[model samples]
Target: MKAFFRGLVRFLLKYYWLVILLTLASAGFSYPRMIHLFKTISTDPIDLLPQDYPSVQTLLKIRDKLKPKKSFGVVLESSDAEAIQRALYDLKARFERLPEVGRALVTKPGYAFFDKHKLLYLELEDLKEIRERVRRKIQQEKLGPLYISFDDEGDKELDFQDLEDKYRKRYGGDQTGSEFYVSPNGRIYAIYVESKKPNLNMAEERAFQDEIRKTAEGVDLKSYAPDMKLYFGGSTRVMEYRALVHDL
Candidate 1:
């Protein structure tokens, strides 16, 4: 090993200039190639994993074959119930007519079915209270006929306004109508918008959402509902919704 090192040192000393020139020439030749490789190198973390790994294969399958269909919501909000309802229906119809929209569902179907079966959903305590109210109403009717009063100052007859106030107090007065699409407070409404385009990539999905926003802007929302605000909802905007609310 000592002899080999001595011989190598002598050789390097004899051709040191040639060795330096060769080294410079090699570096000059390889510099551009190295830069190109660096520029084209994959930065994706998934690309670092071996293709044969189970997790990598699963992720690739999800990215290529099992991509989920994207959908979003268009939210309409206002203090005026009538205006909001009218605008919601109009907007829903317009969205449905768009070529990109697969479907725009607003009001839920089967109102009669839910109305008929709503009693089953009431809690035991609530049902008991309702039964008591019914009993009291029945007793009042029965006793009213027997105790006929000659004076006008007797118990006043129940009128529409009285019944309205009674029920309005029993239930919440904030609700706009009996529709399930409107929020409980009657200030917010949502239209579910599904995409018609198949296998939308990220860029295509963003374009679709932009188209929806444009369609909404084209409509004369102020004419339909005063002080009404439109917003985007669903998976895409959910994270940013809080920021939007703060801005509003």
Candidate 2:
């Protein structure tokens, strides 16, 4: 063995340039396969486990049985509440018109039902206070311009504006007057956009997000609010992931 290794070493030293050329040629041939493997690599933790593992089988079963809907959020921001409201509605309408969008909800349908029954959630004392305020408002409207009292009793008449301000202070935290999802200062709104199809393939998911962005570009948000900006969130990150994998 020692004699054979000595002979091999002598031959390699004599043909060093040829050895280097062959090494480079082998790497050149393998480069494409390396690139292909990188692009097709799986980053999922579940994929790291053996396919026959009990946990892996159970997880696969669960995933197959309960696939989640593909959805993303479109956020609208502006200093003007009126602009945000108008743009929110307009954007929602445009998203709904898209063939890729299953539905766009500015506010969930359940919100309307709960809003109608909100008074039922109030306490007895709160209900009584609301009733008294309503009665005073009615009296103040009926009194009209002819009512005058010279008595020293300092009875202040009810002001609807004050009541409205109080109402806003109580229940309008981070929400607009129309009760849409908003930032704490009421300068931003969000619209939930769900895709019409499932997220079965990364390419298809990218296409879905691309279509949404295209639809948004068609609308002039500045027309509704000068400073209004539109953004996307949620599963839209998948687009970036797919782009990175493709570039790999």
- CA RMSD, predictions in order: 12.1, 6.9
In model 1, which runs have C-alpha deviations exceeding 4 angstroms?
1-69, 109-112, 124-129, 145-180, 197-199, 237-248
Q: Per-residue lDDT for 1-248 in model 2, tens only?
A: 99999999999999999999999999999999987765545544465689999998997888787775578788888899888777878888898888888998787667777678877866687678778867755665678655454544224655356545665688754353555777777777888888887534555666777888888778888888789888887474475565667786
TM-score of each: 0.53, 0.61
**How accurate locally is residue 235 in candidate 2, as Cα lDDT from 0 to 100?**
72
Local distance difference test, candidate 2: 0.74
- Give candidate 1's total backbone clashes: 0
Give lDDT tens digits, candidate 1, residues 133-210: 565556668897675556463555433454445555666663423654677777888877778875564446667787
TM-score of 1: 0.53
Residue 64 miss distance in model 1 (angstroms): 13
Q: What are the clashing pairs of model 2? A: none
In model 1, state the lDDT of residue 118. 63
| Cα lDDT, all candidates | 0.71, 0.74
Best by lDDT: 2
